[model samples]
Target: MPTLVVAVFLAFFAAEYAVETGLLLLNLRRARRSGDAVPAPLQGVVTPGSAARSRDYTLANGRLALVSGAWSAALTLAVLLSGLLPWLHQALAARGLAGAHRFVAFLVLVSAPFWVAGLPFALYRTFVLEARFGFNRTTPALWLKDRAKGLLLSAALGLPLLYAVYGFMALTGRAWWLWLAGFLTGVQILMVWLFPTLIAPLFNRFQPLPEGPLKERLEALARAARFRSRGLFVMDASRRSGHGNAYFTGFFRPRIVLFDTLVAQMTVPEAAAVLAHEIGHYQKRHVHRRLALGVAGQVVTLWALSLLVPWPPLYRAFGFAAPSYEAALALFSLGGGAFTFFLAPVASWLSRRHEYQADRYAVALVPEPGALASALVKLNRENLANLDPHPWYSAWHYSHPTLVERLRAIGEAGRPA
Candidate 1:
């Protein structure tokens, strides 16, 4: 039964990837066919040469399908091929090596092919595609530095947790869920607590916003929204990419964080308008609601995992013995990965709704609809974002409303009701 379930789960993910790739290919072909760059709310002000506009449009939508498809194929191959080893171990009764550690080592080995297969494509898009569109500001040295730091950070944060979870499952057996839930909750809290103060600084320098009119404007918006902020922080985002973004981080006391890349471009009014949108998230209590939802989901997941953890069929189907903790752990990891395949679209839908709500809140508070619209356009254009995308593809995949949809909302806000 467990083996059948695993097979079904894997098949579903494989199908989803195939569909996703088809959609991306269709979209890329369409974008290339359309010569004019779609009008962005940001580019409403600046005129670009026709050739430059065409280049940007093509790069924006091209290569997405190729990258996504290759990644999907690599991951699928890894999961399927790695299962063969445990099958061998189970047949031989060299069972000591078949447990969780060995299973994880097998997974790690499987991942190398996918990692190697995707790296060059990623590099080409970031360097050539983005540079051709005038968005790549990162030098090759800086790019490699960032990748090295990312690897270190992932190891530092992820390795110990993986070991702890595997160890807990192996040792506790039936009661691992309780310990797993507790550990995950603690880790989530710790990441939130330390993210603003510790982890962030390792990647980018953050300084308090200089005392100025912009600071006063931001503080005013925060007060109006009735949320106390730690202070405004500026992160050096330009070192990596020209993409602009802002978000509020921390739970006990959140700080308003803006990338220097964003600040460098927007006027004080525009920046304040963007800040107002972020403040809107807090004003509407979106953060607390999201955290609560996440906690609830974690509990539900733990319960589901508990049901399968004790079942012998699950281990046997995955080609491992019921008594073997390592085999159980590996199967559980693969199951978790499979479940995310279906859940991703649902999560993205909820997130997009939250963004729309926040945008409405921003319009109400700032009353600078034009500025917000312009800011979004410029950010998207500079980042080489696709203005027109396939609706179903965007619905399932995108976290935010497309630029055109956002602009329309802003335009609606400005109309006399």
Candidate 2:
């Protein structure tokens, strides 16, 4: 049984790694073939220089991804196959650490190596890669501070939550997974609700949209769409990067936030169009539907974990002498992606469909027919987004449709039904 499990693990791992490497290489090749030429749909909208930059950006990031993905896969496989995890568990047990405390400590310790290994890549991506393209604005001090806060926040929130999960597992009998699933779903929803007000402020300052025409326009659009929000606000995203975005957080009374860079770059109509697209998400209930789907996924994952946690051979396959919930959870978390990687395209497709729906809904609400398309084109150029991507690569990776697809869809959206 152990041998079979190991074989299955290695097979899935190899397949996932091959697929990832192939898609990245294929995308890079496709980008090289396309050169700097702006896609037909975007020729007039985006300048040749911007298109060239976008191509370079894509190639650079793709190369980085290829390297980083291989490194990550290799490190993960090494850690899993090594007797290190079993040794660590035994060491922790030897130290008189037991139960949830020991489990949390073990997880924290095991995760440290990956975090340390990733720092250089994260730094390069943020400071070197992003800065080369005129996107990075974060100082090293700010970066360090942010990481510190993130770590502290993780410990504060994650430790307690993990302890609670352990408690549920210990006390809830055979249906523990069901209870844990519901609890986790509720926690997820609560985090979403609190993030806009509580968690977000820790990282970046957000201010009210400042009683301007843009604010009035966005509020009016929301009212027109019959979507209620806490308020419109702008985030100081420029403090970190030049990339612009807009999103709403929270379940009820969500706050619509626009990146300061977005506000600075886009015209009033363009901003309105962008906000209208976000509002469209709410109007179409995409947010609620996605949330429900996420909860369902969590339920399924927990149920699977319940089934696997007790199997002794599963532990033996990974070099653990005895079945331990912590080991099982760690192994599952580490290895589950290889098993479920094929599902990414399905998720991406659903997300893209939602995006299309939101875009169409925005078109109906925005005063100018081409406002949303114009905004999208500007965003793509400003963000140095790849205007063209290989079909298979984009299908598997992109949560939102490509800029060209979006522009074409926006045009269709303006037409009479």
Best by TM-score: 2
Report clash pairs, candidate 1.
42-377, 99-326, 100-326
Question: Runs in model 2 with CA error above 4 Å?
Answer: none
Angstrom error of the Cα, residue 93, model 1: value is 10
List per-prediction Cα lDDT, in the order shown.
Answer: 0.72, 0.91
Give lDDT tens digits, candidate 2, residues 272-308.
9999889888878898999899989998999999999
Model 1 lDDT per residue over 1-417, tens place: 766766776686677667767767776666666446545653544345542464455545456556666776666556654666466545445546555556455555544565666777779878977676666788888888877887788778876776777777767767788788888988998998898898888778999999998888888877887878888999988887777888899774688899988988888878988998888788778888888888888878877877876678766665564545455555565446655666767888988888888887777878555778777767765665666666776777888988778778778876779
| CA RMSD of each candidate after superposition | 3.6, 0.9
Error of 1 at 140 (Å): 3.1
lDDT of 1: 0.72
Maximum-lDDT candidate: 2
Model 2 scores what on Cα lDDT?
0.91
